[model samples]
Target: MSEDPDLFSAISSQNQTLSTISPERLTSDQATFELERLATLIRHYDRLYHDQDSPAISDGEYDALVLRNRLIEQNFPNLTRPDSPSKRIGTRATSRLPKIAHSIAMLSLDNGFSDKDVGDFLDRIRRFLRLGAQEPVALTVEPKIDGLSCSLRYEKGRLTQAVTRGDGIIGEDVTPNVRVINDIPETLAGSTWPEVVEIRGEVYMTKAAFSDLNQRQSEENGKLFANPRNAAAGSLRQLDPNITARRSLRFLAHGWGEISDFPADTQYGMMQAIKSYGLPVSDLLLCCHSLDEMLQHYHKIEAHRADMDFDIDGVVYKIDRLDWQSRLGFSARAPRFALAHKFPAEKAQTTLLDIDIQVGRTGVLTPVAKLEAVTVGGVVVTSATLHNADEIKRLAVRPGDRVLIQRAGDVIPQIVENLTPEVNREDWHFPSTCPVCHSLAKREEGESAWRCTGGLICPAQRVERLRHFVSRTAFDIEGLGLTHIESFFADKLIVTPADIFRLHKRRDTLINREGWAEVSVNNLLAAIENRRVISLDRFLYALGIRHIGVVTARDFARQYHEWDAFSKMIGQLKSMRNILLPSLIETEEKYRKRVAKELTGFVNIPNIGNKIIQSLIAFFSESHNQSVVDDLLLEIEVKSVHFQQQSSPLAGEVIVFTGSLETLSREEAKRQAETLGAKVAASVSRKTSFVVCGKAAGSKLSKAEALSIPVIDEMKWQKIVKNNGHISVKTE
Candidate 1:
């Protein structure tokens, strides 16, 4: 029920023994106990670092724990726990935020701390792929940033949702917060992107911004964050995203999650393509032909780490060839073709002065540690994070305790240990009331966080939700910036989204206000009017439904096509639920089956899972929400999305263009192909329908021939496009 002192003693004893004794010498009981201790310790730290933005240990210490656990697990394979830290990617989704199930899990990479480890990684890849020694193994190397991991999902070239890498399987939906980040594009650069793609990357804060933020926090008498990583994580996770918008957060795309189609055939090419699509990728990404080149790049990155604006813990090396990468597959925690070669963790000792609780926009209270100033790496550490009340209890930390601090990868400074544990000190307790609203702060059953029960009455939650409603991917009305929204909300001029549409009635009053003039007032009203005719997908997303992201909203729009039809269907389903399940008489199973049958059409839609279906049913079933939708509908026209119905013969075919074309540019040719409903592939594969070979066609043509795929000349390709795939051959 509390921090077990026995577990801590056992961990301390094992850590000492493991360093001196070989793993093979350890007994089975010792290995099992060590494994259990490591799992508990690692899971505790994972929650601190990932969920709470407060870490208690240094990265080096954590890595040491992991390495020790792995050694023991290897020695005693049968003693390994199912929930072992070695098998997990990150912590589970925080209870404070809504969760999103990733279509493809965002796995972490296996770490390589030394050059020998890197060489072993490369050797393992070669062995996995059954490559010959003479064959060149190309690898893409780039700096691995020390920040929060995020997944940005785009549908049809538009940014839809952004989520944290929570436990890999499910993540917290930070879409509204991410929309405010300037580095992330609202839409793809060109229309040639995949239909659906999830760009995986790090959301980081620059050292300068981190300094400025801490300075501002100090001046405002706010809780000072330990370092840039914590600042970035805290900023991105704010429920009131307007706060996140103010922070200087940057995103650098490293890889991808779920993708409909790949733009390139190699890792370097993929980075370039992703960069062209308006996502900021690392400019240092390089293609290496040999292990020596990879090591050279890694050392170069290490030398430049301190001078860079952002924090990078190490260099990441991944196989360049997509085909070879696919062949290599994955380990339980990471891809076999990739490895994160990490820099050593930087640390220093400091004194713990006090502990403070800061309430977030979502009402979750985070505990921050105020410490005596100490230098770690190049950054000055004035505070560290205790993480939670449980962590505080676990550490038994108090004011005046001399503690060891560490700048984990020179990013976030965290408490390593209490050096003066023998010194008697008063126990620190978490406050029972919300610091911001004085509302009762209660931790839910089976939840780690304490939340405010004030709901919309809490100013923080209200402003945050309002900001989300008018975000770029939502209603997106011009002139309604965060300042304006806050002003309007505070003045009681706008309480709900529908109030924005009804603001025309107050035009005269606004015009007479000190900050407002006739032109500005008219412009604001016009801007509101311009948004009167909106797309169905945007409308659905703007409603701020739980788990309903832009992609899901688009799915709903495409399925129903019309707002009236969608609304009608929802109403019908709600009515059926009410009628069929009239409590006492109907069995729950029968009621569920009846409701499911009535909603079979929606359930059958691709990618529409139980979560989305349940969210929709719940939203429509609520009378207040239905009234809000009805009111909003009265003011705006939700346009139905129309897709081109392709009748061309090339429709649904996968086409590849090779060599030089005389009649059309490659971009134009691909555009034309896509317009005709054909998918484009970069390389020749069994799935390729046709390989259009121009003059001097090379390996692709040969591969196509070998695969028995159709190979057409430039002249024939021109005829096919010109005649809408009704090709006619003429005698040469």
Candidate 2:
């Protein structure tokens, strides 16, 4: 939780660090602290697999810790972090039931395990649409499921809400436990749909209904689960909707979120119009087209994923047009026209039986191993990832070794060998401090992790950053949880996140404490004064910087829309790196690439790269984290970003269109060239700033007339979006 300055360039001057080991390519600074220690061990296994359905590594070691925190934030993009587990998505709803907020950010998908990761997902959608290598594309595929995503919504067609993808921007109002599931429908059947939509999918549970709900929770001793996607997310988050109408939960659909119109125009005509509106989709969906029919429908849905009864783990694909997924948009979080693929990690062996460690909430440590219970694909394996102390000295693993492992989808398992590594059995060690505050745990130099200098007196990093500043994507206070933040931080009655908004000045000392009452301390002080107004991008992701998340705190609250211009742009990049550090402290790596080229010359927001501007200049250069963000800005009120800034004049054009038709419809001419901030490209290069053409045009209108570009035609691109996208185009 430190490493701010000296943005390292030494590790014995490179040439060997690249690890994840089997797969190794990250370049330097000891593999960027193994991508910030696999983003603090995949955010503590995405809070034990999406908020405690209990998973401690496996689905290919949580996809190799989100592909090594997405290849060290794609090759050192400013050592990315700010609580990153690759910009989290699924895991929130700290449940007691009701919570909803997602008018569309339920994302997560971007895997591919092999078949050349599906021929590099069709050569990255033909190089982001400038298509070529015999341009075919198409897609659709399906399968992926392994449940609990949800969504629903609809509107004039009925069934109004449903939620649960939680951390993808709130969720958990399981619309009365998805109204007794009967495969979800309550309406939309024959009403030409689209009066409003939403739809998304998965909810699942079926290996014989998770073995008859774990044989009725093992004859009512209750708590059983561990699979069928954690018994369909603990029976669709039940705070009792008739115990999720007796847990027979199921659903399918696949895609969609926040609609209003799009009844068709493609992702296979909107999942055949969301499968003609009766709900449930994926009868193994299909459509595909070349890269060997999407690897023969992902090996026929991984050879019928064990004779299917819900639980799939990989196939997905998507990209069956929809204006080429709005010109292949989105990447910081997912959906560059979808991909998934997965399935390949199911080996077995077992026995290790010991190694523990744990300690994360940012004190680092990790380790884990355990083992012996052994099952793998049928989900039983007791534990896996040992990712540090340099992978236990590259697996000289001890405690009765016998390893092997590997695994898929069941929460990313791993290990890959050490089957009694030459049975000598005695050298194991590792500890050297802070296994929970013995502190001074160090590690450094070519770091493979050992952290915990006990910052803020590590009671596990102050009760996990005050349970991630009241988590559900930060500052979502509501009934303040994580066991009332560790019973109000062990009776000191709350410590930070501005003392839970100064618990109404200890309203009668949390109503005379002890599981407090008086209407749960006035509903946790009206959910901490309904989050005292929040929103400058969840108050800069509830101030827990370090490679910042929530998409770089909405790209620095949409580029400084307030908190006094985002703390005056991190106090003018820390007073221009403290007025050039003592004469550029002997070429401090050329002033850290000249302060990431002065944050790409005035950071125009797009995941504010350069390692999130060196984690917002190392978190406002810490005067006690700027006095806990100025004591959480004197108990909250941040709210100030509203730039729906969409100027136009085809804001930096690059279109292409080709042999289209009369008026619009090449999907509204590429959604009117992406609502006029153009770039509809699918060919015609020379950074093509034009080339519309309608009547039998062809060869991208002779490659936009051999790259001269500007061509137009469909009535001069509908008179440049009827004069709104601005005029001044002469070539007819």
Model 1: per-residue Cα lDDT over 628-686, one tens digit each:
77888788888988655578767778899999776555755776677677888898988
How does residue 285 of candidate 1 score in lDDT?
Answer: 93
TM-score of each candidate?
Answer: 0.49, 0.28
> After TM-score superposition, what is the CA distance of residue 306 in candidate 1 from its true location, in Å?
0.9
TM-score of 2: 0.28
- Which 10-residue span in candidate 2 carries the lowest summed lDDT? 6-15
Clashes of each: 0, 19
Which regions of candidate 2 deviate over 4 angstroms?
A: 1-111, 114-350, 361-367, 370-383, 386-404, 407-455, 459-626, 630-725, 728-732
Number of clashing pairs, model 1? 0
The sequence of per-residue lDDT tens digits that candidate 2 reaches over residues 1-732 is: 322111121111111222323223232333334554455455556666766678864566578567756755666554465657667776666767778799878888888788997787778677666576887888888888877788899898999888888788897788888989998888889979988899888888788978988898899898897778877887787778898888888888888899989877878778888889888788878887788888987897898788877778788888888887876776557777888888887788978878877655545666777888877655686776666777788778877778888763223366877977475456898898887778888875564667677766778677766765665556755556556676778877787778888878879977987767799789768867888887887777656665465555766776677788777777787777666553525576777777677765666554365766766777678678789888888878888877564698787677878884754357556766777777676878777777878888889898788867778678877877878777867733
Best by TM-score: 1
